[model samples]
Target: MKILNIYRSEPDATTKKLVEIVTRDRESVEFDLNVDAPDYDKLVDEIFAADKTICWW
Candidate 1:
């Protein structure tokens, strides 16, 4: 299954480990919103394409 991980902020160690465990042995894509200008357009596309989406704050 395809999993899309969206980070609202920089991930902490625990969050990182959990995401690793959840995405293990699966196709995953990561998008970070903590940048100068996040691409909402691409994020929308990814959300539509992914089978599951996880947003991390």
Candidate 2:
């Protein structure tokens, strides 16, 4: 299973620590951009193109 965590932080020590705690057991992780739109059709199409998408607001 893949986990996607989105946080609203401008890179900080605390954020790092929290991320470490949450992903400590994970052996691998990949970072990617999260795109959103007011147009549901476009947004869904983009999501379908990706393997998985987790949006945070």
Candidate 3:
């Protein structure tokens, strides 16, 4: 099964780690901003950008 990596907090920092995993698997990586602010599309775009989509928070 494919794994979708999502960082519930500090997406920018987690993005770096996502890159490493993507490089190894040659898969797509997504990013979402979660900090009490409300932005649904922003969140969706992040998940859709990746091959596998998931929510950790």
Candidate 4:
């Protein structure tokens, strides 16, 4: 399964561990929105492309 992990901020230790556990042995991609500029267009494409998405705050 393809999973997309979207982070609204830098991930905490718990969040990072959870993401690691959930995405184990699966295809995963991560996108960070904490940058100066985030590409909504690419984010949209990634969302559509993945089977599941997890937003980390």
Candidate 5:
């Protein structure tokens, strides 16, 4: 299951650890972008490419 996780700034320690464990051998990706300089085009492309998306503010 291709999954995409988007977050502004660094993710919490727990979330980081969980993602590391869960994404092993899995098609899961994460993007950490600046809120002011977000790459809308690339983000849209990833959104379409992924089967599911999770965003954190």
Candidate 6:
């Protein structure tokens, strides 16, 4: 399944580790404020495409 991980800020070590684990078998996408925030309109499309979301703010 598709998983969307939204970070309000840059990801920490734990966040990075989690992404690594989760993406091992399925698709995992991350949207971080430091990078993706400026392109929220495009990110929203991605968000909607995901089957699940993990929001870390």
Backbone clashes counted, model 3: 0
Q: How many residue pairs in model 2 have overlapping backbones?
A: 0
Descending-lDDT candidate ranking? 1, 4, 5, 6, 3, 2
lDDT by residue for model 4 (1-57), tens? 999999999999999999999999999999999999899999999999999999999
- Candidate 2 lDDT over residue span 1-57, tens digit each: 344444333436876676667567653243333334245565556555555454333
What TM-score does candidate 3 reach? 0.38
Off by over 4 Å in 5: none
lDDT (C-alpha, whole model) for all candidates: 0.97, 0.48, 0.57, 0.97, 0.81, 0.81
lDDT of 3 at 5: 57
RMSD of model 5 against the true structure: 1.8
What are the per-residue Cα lDDT tens digits for candidate 6 across 1-57? 999888877788987888788778998887776663268787889888999888876
Model 1, global lDDT: 0.97
lDDT of 5 at 32: 75
lDDT of 6: 0.81
Residue-level lDDT tens digits of model 5 in 1-57: 898988876888977876777677779887878567788899999999999887766
Off by over 4 Å in 2: 7-9, 27-57
Question: How many clashes in candidate 6?
Answer: 0
Clashing residue pairs in candidate 5 (N, C-alpha, C atoms within 3 angstroms): none
Error of 1 at 50 (Å): 0.1
**TM-scores of all predicted structures:** 0.96, 0.39, 0.38, 0.96, 0.74, 0.71
What local lDDT does model 5 show for residue 42? 91
